[model samples]
Target chain A: MKLIMNLMASILLSVPAFIASVHAETAVIVSLDNKNTYTSIDKELVARIFLAKVTKFPDGTTAKPVNLKQGHYLREGFNRDFLSKTESQLSRYWSRLRFSGKASLPKEVNTVEEMKLAVANDQSLIGYIDAMDVDDTIKVVHKY
Target chain B: MRIGSIIGSVLAAVLVTTTVQANSGDLNIYGFMSVGVGILDKNEVTIEDFEGEGNFKQDTVLGIQVSKQVNDNTTATGQLVSRGSSDFKTEAAWAFISYQTSTDLTARMGRLRIPFFYYSEFLEVGYAYNWVRLPSDVYNIPFSSFDGVDFTQRFSIGSLDNSIQVNYGRLNDELTIFDENYQSDLKNMAGISLTSTYGDWGFRIAGQRTEMTLDTEVDEAYVSAVQVATIAQMTHSANPTPQSGVDLQAAASALAEAEVVFVEQRRIDQGQTGAILLAQQMNLDLEVQDEFAFDGHVADFYNAAITFDNGNYSFIGEVTAIEYESGLLVDNRAWLASFAKRWGDTTTHLTYSTSRDVLNSGDSGKLQEALNLQGEDKSVTLGLRYDYDVNTALKVEAQYHDEIMNRGVEGDYAMLYSFAVDVIF
Candidate 1:
């Protein structure tokens, strides 16, 4: 009975950790060259850049934002966690801005590999990918 | 037909160009289509004659946008919209080029929407907003777009995000007023707007001003009456008669005869017997000279709005005022309050709006009375929106309009029900 109770307690404690691992981890990334220039970024700045509200980096360089194609898990996770918006909400927001001729939506890539490649090649480009996909070529500015 | 063909050619060109340029740079094509069926409980709300039945053209609209990023710093965009209210006439909604001047500033020049209200940018895109239609009380501006240049600056203070926009523009268009087509021109149109967001709360304030001129043809009857009144007053002042009342009666009879002949001639020329009957029934007293002209008129519009959203629930309140230093238009004030709650894929909302005219009592005679009769309008709307897919929504709404006052006449209460499908691609 004592052994069974300890097993149940351990299983209950591990449930959240297990669930967390099952959900894909996502991170905001930039070119490795920007790693030194922008060591870290706050959530507001990231949100603004992704939303096309802020077009420049903290160091006053033009920022090119990239987005993942719709229905991508990593993109959805990043939008929900960092921007506090759903895909539908973001689509509506962009529609208003785009139709008004005020702003344009970010460029979208099909896969995480393409995202990483694009970000790695362009110093101004900012994008996001799975946390596990982060490599030395691209820097992770934020993790979610 | 001309507008439609122009839009079609533009769309074809955009499609071909986007396809050809897809591999080189960023070229995006997006569109939204909305169709609604509305039925009024009574014939009180008449729009160009048809009333009291189901109508499909009241809220149907389609808009397509094409954007090309010339480079990292510049973009060109064009949008075409076909509106049912305008009989499915396609027009260029916006055509502009935007340049990112700095990290925080963007400048755009071309034909752009006049940011008159919070929803001005997306007024025709039903999917972007929860309401089947934005409150008509505050959104009833005569014009929606202008050829302009605008600059937007974005900044932040602590936790708050802020954007300020300044615009200069001009508008020249022809519109129908009181059953007569008039050429309207607004020059030196200038506007400024500020928006701020903190956490779940948002605030906005905007103001605009323009110098206007309107040229319209006045009713012959009105012109005759004014002339007769002037001549009669002059004759009485110049030469007093023992039978002055008799002379005045004879002048009034002549004026009435002239009015009758004018109405008869109009009926023959226009073949609008129903309009003539309605005008007579409503006792319309037109108050202008033969060639009605207004020049050097200044108009000012101001608005403020506040909103709060916490994912599942949201609330918005807005107030607007319009002041016109002109003889043809009355000052106006309007306000709206709305609340919505989202549950799962469905959201329900309720809104109440009201508007009133500010009459200029200084003017006497028929004009003052006409302005005074522009009484209050109020409405309550309940709506539901269901996101059926990633980029499509289905909505149903019911609106109740209280008794409305228009053109020296009072309208009865009206209830309108609508169902709409909104899709984005």
Candidate 2:
């Protein structure tokens, strides 16, 4: 009886914590050595950068935005909260722009770790990952 | 020429595959396809081949585009599109070199899509919009592309994102009107479009002017009408002549006693009332033929559109009008309104559209009725689009046309059902 009660308590206590982790805040990050002089960015600028509407950052440095692959959960959250677009909406938008030769899609990485590596290796690149994954090699510019 | 088209398509495919396989640097390749089958309950055709029987050749299309960054500020791009309606022949839809002067301005030269409508540039890309096909009432212009130079400037006003495009171009191609082919030439073409977006609302307006000419063949009905009228006039007039008086001058001179023959021959050639009054009574306008055939006439086109899109729901409305200085051709106006809602992976859309020709009061109006070119129709369509995957979609649509003007004949109400699978890579 005691053993069963302990298992039930543990599961009840950990379930909400697991749910919280899954819905954790997303952090938009830049390289520690990023050339552009900006401590933080607004959601509109982030949306513009990710959409490839603006090729340069506020300070006029060429900005290269990176994206996590299609099915990444953190990427989905970031797209919804920061860009205010759904995956399908973004897909259609990018299709029009890319096929018309007006703009190209941002470089896509397969995993959050790869996203971190890509942004850290290129000072011009900006990407996002889970807040818990933020590290010293990258600077968190915005959170949602 | 058919062999050349085949060879060109083969070469384009080979090049695309080789470049993609090699993973060439700074070279990007993309492709899209939509394979559709449609059938109508009525005997009249709607979209090229959607007649009484099921047809797959009208809406099926494939397109491939390639772009390379030529330098820091320039890019080279080319697109090839194949349509089943044309027996799967491939054509270069766009081939241009774009130079970015600034982050806000871009200039491109070469063959480009005519900026006549909001969706003109990506008209063939099925996945770009919500419809199985765009409404023909607003999109069935004879010309699609022109060899040209265009300047696009992007800026913002308040919270609205704005883009202004100015283009100068010319198109020389074969056009099919009334199921007959004519060599069409559009020169001195100039157009401008402005698009503005604020949050979920979008608006666009455009205008274009061009010098248009068509090499048209003489209508047999017109010839017969003139012949019958002339015979009736010569035989029953004050000074009667034989039925064989093919020579208008001789017949007119036979009426010399009436002093009408002294009128200038130039007046007859100009289609004045004296010589062709009987022809006009017979519902034939020889004047229109004299005014427009093989002669350059000025034309103007106008378009306006508004769109609203949120995550789950969207609405669009568009209107277009065309006018010609010489009223030989139909001056048409078209409009469409559409609403769509998304439920999970499926989107349901409802659309209503209509088009009609503006009839005038003179020889132009008689010509319009005589040729039976006064097109007037309306339709309503319901469709569902299912996103099977991130890059692929499946769509099914049913269109109910209250009236369909097919080749100048009014067709009764009919239902057209179609399905399409669209994909991009």
lDDT of each: 0.77, 0.78
lDDT of 2 at B346: 92
Candidate 2, position B124, lDDT: 89
lDDT of 1: 0.77
Give lDDT: candidate 1, residue B170.
92
TM-score of the B chain in each candidate versus the native B chain? 0.81, 0.82
Give model 1's clash tally.
0
Tens digits of per-residue lDDT, candidate 2, B34-126, equal 999888887755543367788888889999999988997899999999988667879888999999876679999999888888788888899
Candidate 2 Cα misplacement greater than 4 A, ranges: A1-22, A32-40, A60-62, A121-124, B1-21, B44-49, B217-233, B236-290, B361-363, B404-409
The per-model DockQ list reads: 0.53, 0.50
Worst 10 residues of 1 chain B by lDDT: B266-275
Evaluated on chain B only, what is the TM-score of candidate 1?
A: 0.81
Please give the fraction of native interface contacts (Cα pairs under 8 Å between A and B) kept by each candidate: 0.56, 0.53
lDDT of 1 by residue, B1-425 (tens): 99999999999999999888766657778899999888888865753222679888878999998888898679888889998877888877789888986657889999888888899877899998898777887888777888889999998776688899999999888655544455788899999999988877889999999987765334556454646665776788788786765677778887777667656442112222222323343465433321113465788999999998766788999999998765456678999999999887888999999888777553222453433335568889999999897799999988888757765467667888889999999
TM-score, cand. 1 vs. native: 0.83
For model 1 the local lDDT of residue B2 reads 100
